[model samples]
Target: MGKPTGFIEYDRIPSPVRDPLTRTRDWNEYSLPMPVVDLQIQAARCMDCGVPFCHTGEEIKNGVSGCPLHNLIPEWNDAVYRGEWREALDLLLKTNNFPEFTGRVCPAPCEGSCTVAISEPAVGIKSIEKAIIDRGFEEGWIQAQAPQKRTGKRIAIIGSGPAGLACADQLNKAAHNVTVFEKSDRIGGLLMYGIPTMKLEKDSINRRVNLMAEEGVEFVTNIEAGKDIPMAQLKAEYDSVVLATGAGNARDVKLPGRDAKGIHFAVDYLTQSIKDNLDNGGVQTLSAEGKNVIVIGGGDTGADCVATALRQGAKSIYQFGLRDKLPDLRAIQNPWPQYPKVFQMDYAHSEAEAVYGADPRQYLVNSTEFIKNEKGELTGLRTIDVDHVDAERNLVEVPNSEKIWDAEIVLIAIGFAGATPSIFKDFKVAKTNRHTIEAAKGFYRTDVEGIFACGDARYGQSLVVTAINEGREAAREVDFYLMGETFLP
Candidate 1:
């Protein structure tokens, strides 16, 4: 325990943030640095409960009750409280491959299911985590742990997203010659382009990738497994193969006037904005300046679009969600220790409110079609309010609720359906119904003899933590399969 009465003595304190008005003007991260002393105080609040639901990492109502990584939360909390930061980092890295990435971007399901959150605010799990890892970097505690002996087994991992990176990190620990192939030009796949730089800085990815390189893990970018290099060649060269290609088949909004010039998928828009920010000398090439932006589908991606649009000087922005506004508090079906499925404002929401003077989300509404001008450029949208028939998710359009909304640009942020199927060809790997690789009923083994799959390629679009878990487990399974028994964890 951090302290015997620490929970009672201290209250929760979140990480400080920059004022939204000032922060939205730049592409840099907005989270202000937290002092180590203040973060240590917050870490002291961990109660170290007997059961410690925060570490269970179980599935509850499709959400994780605790950390999917099953991070040694309480143990690290104690270490942090005692100011043993190096020890804390060791504990954190024992399970997670990248605490810094998760600390910055992850939603922190651990906090939602926190025992303290049943009453008062939850422990500052995410903030404390961030503090620990950041301090580790600053103090030069983290270093490459190159394996003493090579197993002489070569492993090829396709896709360099969280799943692929995590899998490569673990496989490297087993002394396997791990080579990561990324289709994109950069090493971090989704971590690179999919997420906006304002939330997670590019240097974070660069630092980790460099460290992995020093650890003897070979990274090959701009060389897609199936297309650039034939899949059969990879299978022939590597003793074991892991398919970690993330679920990138973005779900699109099927509406009339879909051929309009200004309509774009969330990934395309986000990627373009990131690329512009990186390549065009900090200027947005796809600027939404002086435009009325209508964003369809409300989620993290939609919120990101809103923030990106605001930064690009959009005149007005509206994000639409077909679902009704959620209750402020947890519902009957939701209980403590299960991630609270209640209304919340993410970083982009606060930024939007700062710029627009209100939350821009329009709930229980549907964009019927994209309204286009004579030039086929999207000038607006025709929308209608919707009502779900019941919890079963039947929908009906409401009469007299139709309205025309002005928009120069429309972005669809609905989320992804599954992985692209073309890449799995030539390898002759079986597939599941969800379009992911077909693994053994309870294992990561695919139909192919020595091929395995994990992360979004096996389980569809999931959180970074879940992807890390999949990669770690898949590596363990791969080790077991190769050695006929294994010691890698």
Candidate 2:
């Protein structure tokens, strides 16, 4: 450890956010870089726990903790504390293929399992990671290095999302020719579209894509695998095929008046916004300007919808959550070393508070009906408070609690239920109960030989880091299947 007692001396600090009044006018990232010295101080707080559970992502008794990527947290923290920026970057890149993306958006389960967090606040691990990668980029440390030899094996990776990109990166390093196919206009699937610009700038995604291209990975955009290019053609053209297409189909709310004109899916609204931003310099589809917007669901996607609506000059915004309000502090049930479900405002919530003079969140509420105007356009919604019981574990509306609220535009941001079933059926791949690709335990393979799946398509979730892990693991399986042995670590 570079600083033995640094954890006792320093307090946790995070990066600063842009002022709400000024930042809401543009579609750019709202986070400001913390000073390098301050970042180093934060890195020094990683304690010398005998068993650093932060990197051991195993589910102990069905409750998983720490990073899924098993990042070398304490090692890199020591490197940063010793002012070894390049060493820290080297250590970071060993496991994580895209630290910049994870550092920006990951929920930081590593911090939740931090030994020091049992008493004091956890070390600013995410911030330290961001600083390390940004410093690497600025110092010309990150560059393209193509393999010297070619194995003459070709791999066709379907979908250019995080999982596909990670697989391509690894297979390319093994001297195989790799080409990534994307259905959208851009290479990054969700990162380039689904996420709001205020959280993750498109330029950051572009930088990595460009580097991957330079490293002998071919990117083909605007190519839908099933429709434009048949599955038979891909199998014949390439020796191996990897399905990394994400779980993009959104879960919908089927209440009355669901087909109203102003109602939209979260992914549709977000994807259109990103396309419009890239094409015409601003959002065009589903404008919220001067309209009362009600966003249903209380996850990161919903928060992003709130931020995007605010940027679109919405008249008033309201976010509804089906779950009960969470306590501000950790509860007895959620003890230390577990990822506590406590209340903490995210970036979008903070911005909404500044503009609307109040938090937009309304908990323990569910919409029963969507009110419509004379023209059949959505006008408002009827909502009610609900109670939860273990025996009768369904949302029961409160007595006389129904009320109508203005809602010109409604965005459903409920989470995804599972992966798209069409692609799996087209390829004759099996699925588990969750509708994700059915892979044997610890081995990511499909029913058919020479075909495999991973990432959101396989596990149905996780962080960017977990997606990368799945991709790396699947690539190793493919390698072993091809050559009868693999040296991938």
Candidate 3:
């Protein structure tokens, strides 16, 4: 242990963020770097408990309990606390293929399960993880090391998101000829488009992609599977095929005037906004400027829309959620080692509040209809307050709670349904009731031999860390299938 009593001596301090008011003007990252000494102190605060549930990576009650990647938390905390920067990086890379991505975007269930958090605040695990990887890059400790030999077995990955990238990296390291095909013009599917720039910078993704290219992972962009190349052709050409295509079928709000001119899916809006920022000269195809925006559904995506609309100079913003606000502390049913159900404002919510003088979220509200003008342009929405009236948590509208909200533009930010079915029509993979590929949990194989599935396509929408884990384990299974035995870990 770094320090037996360090957890008692030091209280948890979160990583500092940029001022909400000031950061709203630009499209830069919200996080600022912590001094090395401060980071070491934070690292020393790790409890290093005997069980260390922080890295257990268990699923409890439909939610993940710990780091899905099973990161070496205690070991790396000790290395960082001792000022062994290179050793910390090595320990971190042993399990995670892309710490840089997960460190920034993951919700950090590890902190929720931290032993220190049972009573006090948890250690800044996510911040420290980001620092370790960032420092590795700055100190020139990270470099490409291509495999020494090739097995001459060809493999094709159908997506270039986290899962596809992780699977490609692992398979390449195992001396297999791996190729990742992306439908988009650039790599990093959700990372490139679904996320806003303030949360995760595009350069960080590009840097990792470049490193992977140097390490002999071939990335093919602007080429979609089952479109440009037939799935049958791909199956015949490659020795193995792994489907990592993400869940693109977004869940939508099917209310009145759903096809109104200004109504759009949250992912479509975010994708266009990001593409304009990157490809065009910041000329938004779907600008929210000077319009009253209403975001239906509350989650990370909805918060991102609020922040994006703020930056784009929206007149007013509001986010509607079907559930009530979370409690200040964990509820009675929520125990330790399970993800805490508590209230905390994310970065976007804080920024919106700073600009609008109040929290932009309205809890326990549901949109009943979308009001539109004669030209078929959205003008407003009809909503009603709802409540969980039974043990099943079914939403029931409150009496006399009908209201009208002014909104020139509306974005549906509900979660995804599953993978787009049309893309896999040629492959003919069976699907589960959840609309995801029919792969038994843990065994990524489809019914068809030599074909497999993983990540969001297999498990439905989940965390980036979980996608990476799926990719790693899928690679292990594929290696075993090909070589009769395997050594991947």
Q: What digit string (tens of lDDT, one per residue) describes model 1 on residues 1-489? A: 878887898988778888998999998897877887888788888888877888788888788889989999999999999989999999999999999999998889999888888888899999988888999999998898899999999999988988889989998998999999988888887788978999989899999999999999999988878878887788889998898888878888888899999999888898988888778887787779999998898788899899899999999999999988888999888989899888998888899999889999999998888889899999889999999888897889998999999898999999887887675675678877777788852379988888888888788888888888899999999888888887866
Q: Which candidate's lDDT is highest?
A: 3
Global Cα lDDT for candidate 1: 0.88
Question: Would you list the C-alpha lDDT of every candidate in the order shown?
Answer: 0.88, 0.87, 0.91
Query: What is the lDDT, from 0 to 100, of the residue 269 in candidate 1?
Result: 90
Please report, as a residue range, the 10-residue window in candidate 3 with the lowest summed lDDT. 421-430
Q: Rate residue 221 of model 1 by lDDT.
A: 86
Top candidate (TM-score) = 3
lDDT of 3 by residue, 72-117 (tens): 9999999999999999999999999999999898999999999999
For candidate 2, the lDDT comes to 0.87
Q: Which regions in candidate 2 have their CA more than 4 angstroms from the true location? A: 60-64, 390-394
Question: Quick one: how many clashes does candidate 3 have?
Answer: 0
